[model samples]
Target: MKNLKLIVFALLLTFCTTSINAQTADEIITKYIKNIGGAEKLKALKGIKMNMVTNYGGMELPVEMVQLAGGKQYVKLNMQGKEITQMASDGKTLWSTNFMTMSPEKSDAENTENALQSNADFPDAMLDYKAKGYTAEFVGKETKEGTECLKVKFTKKPIKVDGVQTDDVSYYYFETENFLPIATEIEIKAGPMKGKKSNSTMSDYQEVEGIFFPFAINMGGQDLKIKKITLNPVINEKDFAFPAIAAVTAEPAKK
Candidate 1:
């Protein structure tokens, strides 16, 4: 009888702990969303355009990024009078410019699909995450950059990697005092950085038309300083389309 009672007690303890963790996660997310201009304002956002700059090899490169609702986005970099499309997705197709070839290349079907699914969480993934079939767990507290933070593990629908379904997960660290997400860590699943952790930190948040944005972002070791942010910017679909390659004109035999 005592053994059964202990078993029941253990089960109850586990349930309570889980309930508390889930509640904490939701509360944190709710506070964060409210801090970042509320849910309605965020949902009403049509698109955003950012003018930024990053230093590469002691050279300052101008960067422009545009992201629209429903998964349309692109990032461009200007270097030495040449503009390069770093990456882009028109909500259906994924593509990027090849530096060596200076030509656009489309991503494989699987990667394109994965990108669309991931970008669908735009504006903010934690907003109505449950409805999007995502889960957020309060994973406890940690210190980042000398500030105490509450860590949350966010998991989304699986994405295909090399034709195999893989877990899509990221960890966000929210400042304990302000509830602002200060850092994010995600695992690199492909390329030379496969199996390594990619870390990004945000700071110097400023408001634009009542919505807060991080003006300074550090991804890996590269820093992007946002100069301006335009909300609801008009976008042209043609900008996201893959450029057509000009056909070579056949020359008549030299007379």
Candidate 2:
């Protein structure tokens, strides 16, 4: 009977451990959602509009960035009161323009694939991720820069854009105490740095419209500081149009 008890106890312990792990994952995600101001508030979020000052070489440019709920993005750089460069994505296609080119061009096969893996949802892409065809796994706790973090391995739904399949995999480390994302590791699939990993750490979080957002973001050597945030502002589709098309549509009649 002692042997039987031991087997039963082992089974019970196994079940408990599994249950605890599952609960830990669930609670982390749930609390994270709540701490960021509930799921419905985030789901109804339309977009985020922010302005920042970026310095390239000796020129300081004012960058206006707008992000939509569907993953579309519009960014315009103003230099000396004139627009110089602009890029936009309509959640389907990504296009850009440079001051030298002066023409908005569609992304090539390589860039198109990169844009495909971009988060096209509001707030955290991992929120309600199962419904969006992605899966996230809890990787337990780890220390980052001397701070304990709950590491989670997150994957994007494998996508094929333009016959190219991107490795849609990344990992996010959330603060164990607050559950806010502290860092991310993503693989660079193309370009000179192809097949390498890039790490980005997020901090300086600010709350906007009941949601916590990282106001200061740093990746690689690029530093982005949010100067302003407009939540759910009325945005015109024309704002996202390629400047060439937008310019032609805005011209006065040549009577």
TM-scores, one per candidate: 0.96, 0.80
Please, what are the lDDT tens digits per residue for candidate 2 over residues 16-38?
87777666766777888888888
Deviation (Å) of 23 in candidate 1: 0.6
Candidate 1 C-alpha lDDT tens digits along 1-255 = 999999999999999999999999999999999998999999999999999999999999999999999899999999998888999998888999888988899988998999898789888888899999999899999998889999999999999989999999999999987799999999998889999999999999899998899999999989999999999999889778777789999999998
lDDT of each: 0.93, 0.77
Local error of candidate 1 at residue 37 (angstroms)? 0.2
Query: How well does model 2 score by local distance difference test?
Result: 0.77
Top TM-score prediction, candidate number: 1
